[model samples]
Structure formats: structure tokens, C-alpha cells
Target: MAALIMVDEPSVQGGRRVSVFRRGREEHLGTAFSDHDVIVFLQAAGLSDPEEVLDDPRWVEWSGGRDWKRPPMR
Candidate 1:
């Protein structure tokens, strides 16, 4: 089975950073400033090709909105 990557909603107070976690795990892998950063985090975590992982639904699961660049203020 493919690894499940969970990306939380962006936090405005945190400089619009989003928390990244592996599904079913409590601890987050890291935080990212944008979608591209997500890929870098995943790579640093020893995952497969970052771009491919980000583009694959089987690997990534996003919360709130996918627009990490300018997430809607909540």
C-alpha cells in the first residue's frame, strides 16, 4: 500500500505554515510554508520522488485547501 501523507490546514499565525504528518501517526513529520516545501519535507523524511508524491492522490491527502501559496484566512 502507498504511504498516506496528511497535510493540515495552513496557519496564518504560523506564517501560513502547514503541518505534515503520516496518516495514523500522532507526531507530525514537519511544517511547510508552501506546497513546494511539502515536497522537500517529504524528501527529507526519506519518501519517494517529492514531485510524484505530491501529485499522487494515493500518497498525499490535504486538509482545508490545497492552495498552500495563499491559503484562505479562517
Candidate 2:
């Protein structure tokens, strides 16, 4: 799975935007790209500290499970 998360896009007035995908292909969540939604999604996904995700590229992949639980991506 792949996820592209954007926080405060455009400007501070903007919200978060997330795109979910599977096998390098988008899953098509069927909605406009909303902003500021990443906080909720991350919490529900059992993850905190959005900075960690932003700081690392590996967090971009969803290996059918929690990527954080795995070793650091290289």
C-alpha cells in the first residue's frame, strides 16, 4: 500500500490530504482531497507523531499492516 499525506497544503488555511493505494495503485477513496484529515486518520491507524512519518519515507508504504512495527526502511 502507498499513502501520500500532505499537511497544511496551499496554506495554513488548508487541511490535510491523504491518498490510499494498494500495490502501487491508488484505491480511489471516492472524495475530494480534503485537508487536515490526516490527524484523525493517523490516530485511527494507531499512530502518533506525524513528524516521524514526515521525516521518513518508509512510512509511505502500507505493507498490509503497520509499517512502523517493521525495521527502518533503507
Candidate 3:
């Protein structure tokens, strides 16, 4: 594992903030508010099939801790 991380913060627009970190360093993975956004982020992170990573139990557990609000698909 490359120490990939995801975190959520309160956004100014009442939406949520989703950040990605790797190797304990913050990565500017961009604004992720939906599954698609996360998938894109994952792809950029190196995974070809984002859903596979999303479906992983380890990722599921980590994502649960973020408490990020998933927005509707755009």
C-alpha cells in the first residue's frame, strides 16, 4: 500500500470536502463530491478501475471514517 488516504471537511457552500493523501502527504486530488468524482480521483491515483478500489473492504472502512457527504451524480 502507498498509504493512500481520503478525508472530508466542511465546505463553504454547504457541500462536503474530499481530500486525498498519499504517503502521509496531502495530494491535490481535486473536489470529490460524488462517486464519479471519487472514481476520477482513484484513477488519477493509479487505479484503472476505480470501482474495484471503491468496493474493497479496506477502502470501505477508511471511507466510513471520512463522513463525507456524497453528492448526486452530475
RMSD of each: 3.9, 12.5, 5.1
lDDT of each: 0.65, 0.40, 0.57
lDDT of 3 by residue, 1-74 (tens): 53354535535442434455656676666766666777777787787776876546455334344445544445
Q: Tell me the spans in candidate 1 whose CA falls farther than 4 Å from its real position.
A: 1-3, 14-24, 69-74
Query: What local lDDT does model 3 show for residue 26?
Result: 69
- Name the runs in model 2 displaced over 4 angstroms: 1-8, 11-13, 28-36, 43-51, 60-74
Kindly list the per-residue Cα lDDT of model 1 for residues 14-50, writing each as its tens digit: 3333334555564566777766777777777787787
Predicted model with the maximum lDDT: 1
Candidate with the greatest TM-score versus the true structure? 1
Better of 1 and 2 by TM-score: 1
Q: 1-74 in candidate 2: lDDT tens per residue?
A: 33454222222222223544445664433222232344456555456775467445555533232222222345
Best to worst by TM-score, what's the order?
A: 1, 3, 2
Task: Predict model 2's lDDT versus the native.
Answer: 0.40
